[model samples]
Target: MRKGKWGKALGVLGGSWGAPPELCPALTAVFQSLVYHECHFTNGTERVRYVLRYIYNRQQYVMFDSDVGEYVGFTPYGERNAKRWNSNPGWMEYKRTAVDRFCRCWYKTFTPFLTERRVPPSVSISLVPSSSQPGPGRLLCSVLDFYPAPIQVRWFQGQQELSEHVVATEVVPNGDWSYQLLVLLETPPGAGSPTAARWSTPRGPPEMPPDAARSKMLTGIGGFVLGSLFLALGLGFYLRKKVRGGAGGRVPPGPERLPRQPGLSGLLGVTTHANTNVVDGRKAFIILSHGFK
Candidate 1:
């Protein structure tokens, strides 16, 4: 490989114009290799997205061909690249190795020209201090429910784990089966509210104003009452309709009649004292119309 000339050519053609000539050869090799890998990809945008998914955060990278000058380097997969990249039992291990190799290669070969930007892996813990009065309250946290089973929960006051004052309650499973662990901390002296004053000791609770505490309890009760009222109203309406002989709604046509049971008719009065034995046609029609009701 022609080092000096190749480096300059690769730097310019590979889109690494800022890189010095000495570093060109290494950058060129990486660029060319990436290009070869990307050749199998049909969509250029997809290739770029795939590279970005693995990289997490990316810096400027140029591509070089052994014969051609420079072009953009990218992965063959799209933004949803990881989904396309098949994973198996050993896939995760392979990915870790690849990341280490890439980091080492970029650091050694590119040096000052190819700056290695470190993006720290992040884990966010939303600290919700139970009612700033250093007392019994629930600390709720949101987390992904599926895939990785058996999550870990820990409580720390500043640096040390809170042993005496804290207890992890039952891990409640949500409707979706995701788990949430509530940490209950008993109130201690000098415990201040989360929003109020800061505590002198790391473990002590913050004192919340009495009014604030009262208001929180009242709000919870109010919500419960409202919910109960709606439930009761729904249930009462259902029962009322059922009890009123199941006939309280819009009236059915007057002609509608109940079918007589086979044996039940004999138990009822079969009264008949027929005084109008002589039936005129007009009188019979009039009686028939009245009976329809």
Candidate 2:
């Protein structure tokens, strides 16, 4: 009976692609609640994924039709490390692992859709100040959606249908087969109300910046950074070894060569005088005084 209830609840919250349409309202509420919690904060996708994974694992959900093959069941807990079925971990472990894997896989598959479709962005003002100031209000909020086909953008305030004031001012075509809608609002205080406002869009609210779309990009690059760090360290070590020891870590200089002196004997082509010297084999020459001559 408890299992049936869980199944019903899951049906409402939503499931893998083939989930049946006969889902109970309670089940739908569960999915709604998941969106409510998941979409309210930054990094909510990660939390939602983790929650879905937990639910799928704990529920022992079947991933595929039994007609395709044997109906493997789920094991919530992981397998014992040593227990083996012909070198493979036993059946229970395998089943549990499969469930865990599917949990991760399905979360990856559906969480974004659930987030995009379910919550829809809400740009609302908590309070509006008087038109006494130049600005529209304390904060006049708006939301722009770039959803693909079958999804439309609409605006609501306090559950009343706002038609004339609301406008689908702009539709920008994205290369990715999506259309962007810009919704605008001008909230200023009126005679009695704390907040009063209307919507404005020549085309629509400004498109969300590309940076906003690329949230969590750094997390993806983290693995590459680790690998690069290791490579750099290895190269640095090799270079240090090649350089040997020196000031400022530069390579030490090699042995110096003696500078060649000018060889007067070779250049002048004079080997010996061939004269017997008086004291140190010197050649004697007589010179007359030029000036006197």
Candidate 3:
């Protein structure tokens, strides 16, 4: 049925659409309507529901319900409209054919993805000051970024489950097909309250997807750092022992402390004076730089 006919009929009923009889008559009136559909896919079968709501000058006037299969009125003006429209057999047949022509076709064409996507939820528990609430402090548990709408949440104080003065919100849509939920526990303000939250799905909560990957990366980095530190320490000890090589493991002397050999200082034409003498074909020399010996 055309909406223009419905609006014009309500206009002739004389402005009693939830307004008083003494209400002023206007030369122009605003009429609006909302048409919406609910399509469902269940067990491989599709179902559809169609609704149409009318608003006359900002007041709710009438609506057409699929369950009733006809128009239902809200105001006096809309009641007269429903009676007139239901009497017409031609118009009533059009409304009956809407299930196949409008709602069923809409369900088949648009609602192929009735099944919701699932994602694991992340949870956090915090103790926050609450001036507006009855308790001295509130333990707030937020379950974020989950899908499929339905989830389970709980609050715990050590091994005990808490229930009193608990406030929880309905699942809030994040507009990107995910949902969030908040649960808060009321407690007396104090330190050292070990509160926690458990967020689970119907099947049980999976491990956090991002945190699992991050933990692996952090563990590998820690192992690499420890291995490098031990390798550097081992190399340092090996070099120190090589540099101090001798009979008693002493560092070698500098050039100014050398005792003159028979063919070395004269062949290079460089002379170093050290107390030396030959005794029974063995050279005896004095040490110079570190200490005289």
Candidate 4:
């Protein structure tokens, strides 16, 4: 059996020539037996194949290919059985020789097709505000788009490497053969204290200042709030003016005149005894005519 570049099984080959009747029964027995042998081969990003089955009892060992990686191993009982059977020095040496021969053959067959595998990661660092249970802030270090899986991430405060208040997530696959890891440092509130995040896959280290980060966040929020408030007030004033102008038209060419009552005219801009009496009489005459009509 051969697997395609994507690790999927391409095809299967089987032959049953010159096999004895006892061999068939033994193969069937091996299928039900717990003892087995398994082998796997892969070319990193592309193809993979697996062969697994009971070693004896009338069955030829099964072989298959798949798009996904496969893991096969004997159970504890099978392991104990093998150990007991191979306890003799001759059997042990023979088993080692067989395994070595198989490995040599597999290497010779597949090593030429394996591609070069090295991919660097993209690293980013951020300061996230967190609650004060552990600290007042958190420094997040993200390593993304890396390959080969094994990576180390570290946190530092000044020249000293920090272990306390540090949390790291497992290496997560990105489903495209790349991986990512997130590390967080719980930083204490301080003034201009610098924290650094370091990673093995990515070379350079990035630094973050606690005070600067917090101040920047606050500045952004304050600017947004102040801008919104000014906008609201401007909109409100414009709407109010629009409604008043639509209803009342332009101001009549002077200071607005008030009704003349029994109050004295000490109020500034208040004309206590102007020609409003004539104006009021005309307005009353117009209202009375309208009412009568």
Candidate 5:
């Protein structure tokens, strides 16, 4: 096989692919040979790693790691191949320049495209219901529907970051180029007002402010309380009117006959029950029930 040049650099790996198949007559089996490049982005842009690798039968055969700047072999056959390939001046020069020629050059070209494809995760936070830890609330922070899975989710109380009690889920692939994750923050925030702590994500939008969230919750509670107060006042007025009307029309507990007030009872949404005692020669007071019609 004629050795060409050691050149070319990455896409994703993020994306990984192999070379053409080679037939091995000694074993009467076809062993596939593969070649691909990988770009690893780290915390520092200066620390990005570019690698050109070769494979045989799905095992690593040889590689030109940018950090190492040479060919490395993982197997005996690969060692012989690497030694022969590394001996050439053209191979060395190509390997050395591949970082600048392809890695950095294409890296700059493709970075904006990657950035354009970046999908920010949607986040929501809720207090985790725990019968055991009811005193200090546990928060379940749901981070959902995102792309380019690498992300960091954190908890913060005002400007201070809370690291001790934070918990997170593995970046779960949603099977359609999207991802989901669930992070949990334990206690601390629950010790004070609902606005005592907040959540944050460096790669995502700023966490919902604790104060804003508290305000929304308080607004809902206030509306509920106001509605209940109005309902109670209306019910009180209705009952007061019914009582006054019944008292004025009712016959006293004397020897007078008890007249049925079915029309008034139906109108008042009440079920009326009364009894007259022959032995005592007195009429029992009427009983009104809202439960039964």
Candidate 6:
């Protein structure tokens, strides 16, 4: 069971996800008791939770508790609240008396009925692509399924801690009896630089190197280009060979031969007329059939 401030977004809790029907009246009473306060409540078989926050003009006070009515956590206004509360003896005395009385009463009535249990967490880490950087990328460390809230997570490089380019989400309840948190780390562009995530819980030891990932991507592209070049060369060679073979096998026509006459042959001092044809780098000739004149 748990409760927290939802501000103006309280309307979101009006449907099935809202507080249990049995606890609405008690929560409404707590809200109306103060001029300006927001209240949320959750009740389960094992535990009951309540969170009350008071806001007047600008002053604020946040208080939370589980099972028992005694405040497990409390914060009043800000640094100014400490100074102002201490300045007045009567107000300081009243505040102390009220807290002691509330603790004593709640513990006596409810502590005996509380249960003892522990829930272990589930953690997952992954690398996600980021548009903020052209290469390299971002890492997401997700911690989930833990019981009793509040866990610590940190980023590291070898033994050195990484403080910059990191973003963390607040602890959020998982509807079930667990909580979750998300921590993001931005990897700087570099070759073979390793990044690690360390968590207080016993679940994480995830490491990723930006250089190795980049190298793999480049290797795949290089293989594709080399293969394409070989394929193109093979196709061109086959086409050239086919054309040469066709040219070498073709036959050229023989040149026309003129008829020989007996009188003409004597005048020309020739016994035969010849015509030549060239094919496949060899020459041939046709000789006229005529006797010497």
RMSD of each predicted structure: 30.1, 35.2, 27.4, 28.6, 23.1, 34.0
TM-scores, each model vs. reference? 0.18, 0.19, 0.39, 0.35, 0.43, 0.32
Instruction: For model 5, state the Cα shift of residue 35 in Å.
Output: 1.9
lDDT per residue for candidate 5 within 197-217, as digits (tens), equals: 232223323433433444566
Better of 1 and 4 by TM-score: 4
Give the higher-lDDT candidate: 2 or 6: 6
What TM-score does prediction 6 earn? Answer: 0.32
Provide the lowest-lDDT 10-residue window in model 3. 284-293
| Model 1: per-residue Cα lDDT over 126-223, one tens digit each | 33456555433333323223211243444433324445655555646566534444444453312221211111112123333233444566666666
Candidate rank order under lDDT = 5, 3, 6, 4, 2, 1
Q: Where is model 4 more than 4 Å wrong at Cα? A: 1-52, 55-116, 133-136, 201-293
* Residue pairs with clashing backbones, model 6: 192-211
Q: Which is the better candidate, 2 or 3, if ranked by lDDT?
A: 3
On TM-score, the candidate that comes out on top is 5
Model 4 RMSD in Å is 28.6
Best by lDDT: 5
Model 3, 154-197: lDDT tens per residue? 65554476677788999999998788998876664233443445
Off by over 4 Å in 3: 1-49, 60-62, 72-84, 87-90, 105-115, 124-141, 148-150, 156-175, 182-196, 201-293
The lDDT for every candidate, in the order shown, is 0.35, 0.35, 0.55, 0.47, 0.56, 0.47
- Judged by lDDT against the true structure, how good is candidate 2? 0.35
Cα TM-score of candidate 5? 0.43
Candidate 6 residues lying further than 4 Å off, grouped into runs, are 1-116, 188-190, 201-293
| lDDT value for model 1 | 0.35
